[model samples]
Target: MLITVGDDTATFDAFDQSSQVHTTIPCDTSEPGQVLLPHRTLHDVVAKLPDKPITITHMGSAAQFTCGPRTFELPPMTLDDYPPLPDMPPAVGTIDWSDLAAAIREVGAAAGRDDTLPMLTGIKVDSHDGALTLAATDRFRLAHTTLPWDGDDLDMLIPARDILTLARTTWHGDVTIHHDQRRLGFTLGDTRTILRLIDADFPKWRPLIPKDSDTTIRIDRKTMADAVKFTSVLAGDTGQVVLSITSGQVTIASKTAQDGAGEEVIACDTVGNELNIAFTSRYLLDALAGDGTALMTFTQPGRPAMVWPDLPCEEGKVPDADRGHLLMPVRLPG
Candidate 1:
């Protein structure tokens, strides 16, 4: 890591084996020399410091940190050995940082945690019908969403951890995106993030989604979510809840050999065959996470169930298309 101080601005550069970050912040410097410091340790110490401004004095091999009467010196590592980060590609487009962050958070719900399958560990960003869509699956459930993007088409796999860290930031405004054949860069104001694009092919997942359905139902999101929470108390270790549909209502029931049974019936608008379907209790809660009425479509009793939020999302950002979450059912003998 290297820190170069100018008359009014200080440039901080840090890089690991694969990723890099650069930030330029306004500061007052007299000598305007370079200081080498440990990025991780400096981050930890600065995060614990008070909000007041701190002073840093560059020494021969160590930097002195001073705030009021508190002071310390940290010996920095050699900056000459640090490899230069790859250059950021040309600016292709920009996206609303908040919207992109939200989409990544939502679609990441279905990303697999198994590190052995590197391709399944993050969201896949690609163009669908000339629109940007994000999709992720953990084998049991899948989350798909589309967001507003205006630029040349891009297809890349980004690690969930890296992007989520960006999403968690409080920064507001559009993020300038840079991409080429080898590296991807996200720049906002004086800060920038560069990461190597994961070099693995995402699985072919379109066919796993059903083209037709045997049943479809529209119901209040809160109604089903609350019921699942209530009935899952007796669902035991399996945490399975059954949706038994009749004419105009659905019975949500859960039972276990040790514990008794719990049941709750809710009214829903059913447009197809009345069938009994079972899903993991947590999966139902995740699918029904937001407001707005949810539209659930099914193929059969034991197959996958698709959940869609059939209402207007954030204004102007969402397109007029079906964004669905496909959930695989939990199989058990009845």
Candidate 2:
């Protein structure tokens, strides 16, 4: 394979390259044939490259690349070089990096932003009968989404952080995921990453989401998010924020020893019973930050509530996807 650049070119011939001169590094090909370069070396090389066209060929564990002025052969990188990453399934459904990554990032933030729960480090991907479900949970909160796929049958869980990393590094294209019980593998164009799944069983979370609600309110998502954030200063470690909805107004209030107390009110349309609810200020903020439309739906006080972007399917409209925050309420100050 030969790749050309502005003024320099690198070429590799699988048929003619002498086996004796080309050093072959042993790698874990048990999962699948893949290659990874030294993380530091890979980063430095890409950073120094000009904005010229680059060509890469996927030849199992060995890959050939040509960047401007520099032509070098990179041997396969073994998993041992870096910390272990969870292996993703070998085949992913129809791959649209943009959509897939957006979904991943949406869920990843819920798990990544808080390190309090180690299990949240992984994303539970369950594939059964052509449907794929991706879920993440941090004990106190959970985010999940479903997508249809056209591949194999199986259920697997992989590290959420590693999948997020893959999402960030990949551009719009198809990615190949290879999996067996022992490990999960991923191939995106010429890049490949393998990760080791955490052996712990992901909690049975489907039942936790509320299926019905007595109270549903629609409020401006951004406006409400800002209100909660503004009041969280007073919601410190006591981390308590109260949501009181009556008639047509929603009030968010909080109090902390150092920050004293604060409150913000926003307009909303409420239905069913009038109620007051309280939640951890930080948890509410994370749910609001999720990508969605302007309006968020509050189901009921102390019940699972969902948030949605105001206008979906519009330019910059947060996709109309299923995402919500469920917080067990805290006792209010008497």
Cα RMSD (angstroms) for every candidate in the order listed: 4.1, 9.6
Once superposed on the true structure, which residue ranges of model 2 sit more than 4 Å away at CA? 1-38, 41-93, 112-120, 290-303, 308-323
Candidate 2 accuracy as TM-score: 0.68
- In lDDT terms, how accurate is model 1? 0.82
Residue-level lDDT tens digits of model 1 in 197-240? 67888888777777666777779999999999999999998999
- What is the clash count for each candidate, in the order shown? 0, 23
lDDT tens readout by residue for model 2, 1-334: 1211222322111111101001122222223323455545555776777787655554655666577776555666553553333334446445556777777776665564444555556787887766677777776667776666777765766777667776776465776667777566655554455666666577787787655455556676678788888888777777788888777888999877777999998887765657778877776776677443344444555555555444333221223555444544566666
Error of 2 at 210 (Å): 1.0
What is the lDDT for 160 in model 2? 78
